[model samples]
Target: MKNLKLIVFALLLTFCTTSINAQTADEIITKYIKNIGGAEKLKALKGIKMNMVTNYGGMELPVEMVQLAGGKQYVKLNMQGKEITQMASDGKTLWSTNFMTMSPEKSDAENTENALQSNADFPDAMLDYKAKGYTAEFVGKETKEGTECLKVKFTKKPIKVDGVQTDDVSYYYFETENFLPIATEIEIKAGPMKGKKSNSTMSDYQEVEGIFFPFAINMGGQDLKIKKITLNPVINEKDFAFPAIAAVTAEPAKK
Candidate 1:
């Protein structure tokens, strides 16, 4: 009888601890969403256009990124009076400009699918994350960059890495005082940095059209400083489509 009582107590304690942890995570997320202009305002966001600059090879290059609500986006880089379409995707087809040839090339099947899946998180991933079949857990408090933050382990839909499905997990560190995400870390699944972790730090947050956005983003050791942000900017869909290279014509030979 004593053993049975102890077992029941253990089970109840486990359930209660789990419930408390889930509640804590949800509470933190709720506060974060509210602090960043609430869910309604975030959902009302249809598109975003950001003008940024990054230093590449000791030269500051102008970069423009525009993303629409339904996973349509493109990034254009200006280099020495030349416009380069680094990457563009119209939700289905993923393509990028070949720098050497200055021609558009479509990405492979695996990459395209992965890009599509990543872009599915419009506005923000934490908003309606549960509906997207994602799980969030409170991993306790941790200090990041001299600021105490609440860590949340977020697991989203599985993604294919080298033909094998792998967990798409990320750790978000939010400021405990303001409930704003300051940094995020995710393990790289492919490429030369396969086993390494990628970290993005955000700062200089400013409100734009009722929503807050980080004006300074450090991603993959590159700092992207935002000069301007336009919400719901009018855009042409053709910009995201693969470009048609003009055929060169040979001059007629004189007899």
Candidate 2:
């Protein structure tokens, strides 16, 4: 009787180990994709454009985003009547301009650093996380916004940005039952806002061209708040054009 019990216990332990190992990187990634929509639907996307309105401390600002299939991206912001732009063509080369400060800058060490950090908010990048050489793992489960979710972390492989090489970690909380990402948190790498933690909450998902997009996003950190967001607005490539200038700089305006 004692020998039989030992055999049974060993069998159960082996079964549990096998089950855990069966959860591969591909399987984990596929689950995330299916939870959103599906691989087929996501692959069908060619481009996306969206408009966002954010209110922070009683101030309203407008932002526009555009993304292409091959990891190219663009962002334009109109804050208090000042326009700023950033764009990336191959994930390495970046260009930006700040009409708000009347400064035009080419992609350099600092500009590239800022773009790499900002790319986290792009929806297209989220969908292609695996293909971009990013590693994702199931970090267990938690509750967010009254919904139970699986916590996942995306760690980017070290790469050169703005002439500097760095790695970043981003945490995402995905609704366990639905697999939709609800919240994201990232640490700033290099900037005046460096060393500060930033967060964004997603809501109001709507389907555009067979893919779902978060029409509302609330981002806040460093006493700055992005209070509202809009999606699927008309934008042209010319809007991301950078003006001829020496370097980019951010300075506090006089009061």
Best by TM-score: 1
Q: On a 0 to 1 TM-score scale, where does candidate 2 land against the true structure? A: 0.67
lDDT (Cα, tens digit) per residue for candidate 2, span 1-255: 999999999999988755653354345556767766787776665556666666546777677667655445777778678666744344555776655655655677666655655564355455566677777765677887788876777777665545677776888887766667888888877668888888878877766555566766667732223333333344455545454446779898999
Scored against the true structure, residue 58 in model 2 reaches a CA lDDT of 76
**TM-score, one value per model:** 0.93, 0.67
lDDT string for model 1 (205-237, tens) is 999877889999999899999999999999998
Question: Candidate 2 at 49: error in angstroms?
Answer: 0.4
Which pairs, if any, clash in model 1? Answer: none
Best by lDDT: 1
Runs in model 1 deviating more than 4 A are 1-4, 246-255
* Whole-model Cα lDDT of every candidate shown, in order: 0.92, 0.64
How much lDDT does candidate 2 score?
0.64
